[model samples]
Target: MLDLIIRQGRVDDEGPLADIGVRDGRIDQVAPAVREEARRELHAGGKVVIPGLIEPHIHPDKAFLEQKMPNRSGTLEEAIRNTAALKARYTAEDVRERAERVLEWAVRRGTTTLRAHPDVDPIEKLMGVEALLALRQAYADVLDLQIVAFPQEGIIKAPGTEELMREAIRLGADAVGGCPYNEAGITETRRHIDICFRLAAQHGLPIDMHVDFADDVDDPRYTTAEYIARKTIAEGYQGRVSLGHVTTLGAVAPEARASLFELLAQAGISIVMLPATDLHLSGRKDRRTVRRGLAPAKELLAAGVNVAISSNNIRNAFTPFGLADMLQIGLLLCHTAHMGSPGEQMAVLRMATVNAARAIGIGDVYGLAAGRQADLLVLDTERVADVLVDQPDRLYVVKRGQVTVTTHRTVEVHRGPGTRSGERPAAGPSRQADRIREGGVPR
Candidate 1:
């Protein structure tokens, strides 16, 4: 017998209604109707079912620190300095508590995976990594958490951070991370990138660098994105290197941006757009004319580059606001990136789902397909087009064939004026109300 079966569900938001059978924590069959018997049956009632989305980038250790240390300056430098102060007081327990709260929100909102970049600098020492490492085990069933040993303070400038980053990987980090922009100067920043690549090569891990994270394309600080893209090809890290933030691409000369896009596509590098943090921390130095420091998603997609959007932070000094919701991220991205048409809206959806899963190298086993891991979201909306507009109630969240988070909401409908519901008194007994049946129920 199948472990679970979900029927009358909509896939791709608009495809033909499909029924999925799950067994042994994997999707067993997908068809218009699944007739086999099952131990448990979930009636979607024509709800929308989609692959569980992914948050390709986030900093769980630094999450929820906005209250403790606020960044009044609202600049990247100030955020880093203030966060370092908060990190100093961090203990294993402290980090885990905050991280757990964030995870609870993410999973409840239908995010089944996250790439958590926990700092590994000397000031924070190993406290953040240790907390997230344990969280990886604790939430393994709920979250496919990928930890990155992020040298947020810069490996070269911080001196001992390189060792700490390596140690973090040894202690269970899944990937190597770096904030090359946080380095002292162009030379130090270049060297920091070299060190990150070297470490990833040594440990055979993927590289996810925070590169080109400024708003002023003319500034010399926006130096590492092209360098990282070129080096990715030289070091044979294609398809394994991801760059986060990349906000400066918007301000660069169109020709230069075009060249960079080509290089990124050639290297198979992924661009993870972090709108929450980038739009806040970046462009802070610009006074005369402020720039909207967000990645050029439309241009990058036009160039055939892999692009995805993520919530880089939540209630941290860097972002100050977030709820770990990818649809919210996509909707905001649509506004910032000017992607509002029907096709653009759907493309933004892919940014949070398929593109996100691929950014973290989890696409193969992470979709609403037969034989894939049973991670899915069932929304109360019948059409995929209304999923975002309605932000439909999430009826069911299935992870590994086991129902995880389920929410049910009820709406009271007044049938007619004579029914005296009075919820909408302005139009008491309209012709629409005449459609109500004799039992005061809408037909």
Candidate 2:
């Protein structure tokens, strides 16, 4: 017997209809039919089943820190300053409460895994890091949270930031983070990168950074991220480095952009695009023909560099919107980048699922297939295009073989073609079997 069985659902990647059976928190069987009874059966006759989505970049710490002093001005610098002001008053309990709320929203929206960055500024007493670590422990079963010890306020520009980053890593942070462009100078930025690499190698953690979010074209210090990528590859740490929000790369000259792309691709550095935050934080100074200020997603994808999109900050100091929905982000990408073709849409879908998983170094533990954990979502849609266009409600969310959230679909009654005298259609196997044989549609 199985713990749960999803009946007649269309599997992702355009596969045939099958019943997915789960037992002991793993996908036990996926076939045309399962004879054994199940404790619970979800009827998904006209729906689609897909693997749970993963968001690789987010700021749960900023969510907690910005509760009191929200960003009024929409500029990136104003958001940073406001967050700094708010971080001064943060406490462990306060951070935990607010971060928990954001995680709950993520869970309800079909995101089971996330990589959240926590601020490591020393003057704020590292309250953001402390709060996220505590919350990660508290919600271990429901969510797989990886905390990035991020120096949001530049690693070298802020006082004692390097020591605080080390302190956060020692406290069980999963990765090392930095903002190279925001540092004082190229030398300082290179110093910060060296510190991150040293800590990551010593602790066996990954490196994720807010690389370059500015749009200044003449700045030479913007190339520190490429330097870090090259050094990481030379030291034999390929695929363990990720660059977040490289917006300035989009604003650089064509020759410079090509060179940067070549270096990143050769160094195996993944790029993360934050659509929600970039739209809000960038291009504030341009009066006419404002730039999108986002990284070149299409170009990066074409160059064989792994690129993924994220929600970044949700109702936090950076942006007061963003609701943890990557589908919405995908739609925005389609509009902003003019990726309206069928193949391009499929690529973006993969970005939200497979590519994001690879960005955070958790691809093996994800996806919908045999030998994988039974974490899946059943949506009330027939095809991938329909799911993205309609944004239907999730009918069932199965996590580790248990039904985490289930919403029933309402059925309506209709008169048969040849009904007579208040008599209903036959309800025996003959009628049911005939309907099945004829491939009857669900009511």
Candidate 3:
């Protein structure tokens, strides 16, 4: 007998109706008819099933700080100051608690894997890093959380940051992260990139850096990210290397942007676009007209370079409104990037799922396939456009061979024909309403 069978589900691949059988934490069979009986059966007749989405960029440490500072100015410098204040008062327990909360929200929304960057500046003693490492072990059963030992402050500009970043990696951080553009000058930024790449190579870890976030194309000094990518390739490091939030590329001269794209693609560098954070940070200096400071997503996609969209910060330090939902990210990308075409929408969806998995170097066992892991989500909507439009409820979220979360559909009742004046039908309690009445909190 099969461990679990999900029938009548519209498999993402090939757009066919099939039953997915799971056994021993992996997908056993996927076909039109599986004759074997199963221990448990889930009916997914009117639902769309796709692989669990992955988020490539997120700040999981905001859950830990006691002081909740707001970015009143909404500029990068102001955001940094606010986060610095919060980091000053952060504790290990506080970070652990907050990371857990953010992660739980992500999983319920169909994000099973995340690459969370925790601030590991010189002032904080790597408290965020320690907390996330502990969380990785605590939630290993249901979530895949990778920690980036990030220097939120400029790596070379901040005092004693190099040692702190190396220490974080020593303490089991999965990657080395840097913010080069935030440094004072081009020379300092290059120094930061060199340090980050050197440490990554020394420790044999991946490099994921927060590149330029400027909205001006004439910022002639912002090319350290390209330099790092080239150097990383030349050094014979064959691991995953990613660049997060290269927003300045959006404003660069079209010719320069195209040239940079070629260089980055040749260097085998991937990019993560944090739409929410970019929207929050860019165009602050403009009074009458505001520019969307996001990277040239459509152009990058056209060049056959992998681009993944992510939720950079959640109701925490930098950004105060995020819930770890990739659906929301996709919708925002559609609006911000003018990706309203059917093909463009599908590509945006891929950014949150398959493309994101590629960005984080987890594409081998990801996506809905015959022999992949049984990580899937059943959405309530029929068409992809409807799904993005409604942001419908996730009917079921399956991780591994077990059901992680299930939400029953709520049927809406309308007024019947020949109804009496001011007479309404007696309202029956819904499964969700009953659960809410009974204080059925999310698991």
Best by lDDT: 1
Against the unseen true structure, what C-alpha lDDT does each candidate score?
0.83, 0.77, 0.79
TM-scores of all predicted structures: 0.92, 0.87, 0.90
Tell me how candidate 3 scores on lDDT. 0.79
lDDT by residue (tens digit), candidate 3, 1-443 = 88888897765423467788888878898788788999998988856777888889998886423235667888888888877877787777777888889898998898888899988887776888888888888877778889998888887678888888888888888888988887888888888888887888899888899987888855544556568667867886533788898887787677777777877777767889999889888999998789988988988887767889999888754666777899998899899999876567777888888888888888888877777888888888654434566687888888887888888665655566886656656865532211111111110
Top candidate on TM-score is: 1
Worst 10 residues of 3 by lDDT: 434-443
For model 1, what is the C-alpha lDDT against the true structure? 0.83
Of the pair 1 and 3, which is ahead by TM-score? 1
lDDT of 1 by residue, 1-443 (tens): 99999998877443468889999999999889998999999998887888887999998888999988899999888888999888888877888898888888899999889999888888988888888888888888888889999889888778899889878988988999989888778888888889989999999999998888887766665757788888999999999998899888887787677888899999999999998888888767777777778888988988889899999999988999999888788778877778876567667778888888888988788777878999988887776655555666667888899899999777788695567663654743423312212211000
Off by over 4 Å in 3: 12-14, 63-67, 409-443
Ranking by TM-score: 1, 3, 2
Query: lDDT tens digits, residues 1-443, model 2?
Result: 88988888877434478888888888888887878899989888958887777789988766744556777677887888887777777777777787778788777777778899878886565787788888788766667789898887877788888788888888889999878777778788888888788888998999999887877656656656578767978878888898888887787678776777877888878899988888888888888989888888888888778899888887876777777887777777877877676567667777777788889998776777667778888888876544555667777777787777766676556676875646656664421112111111210
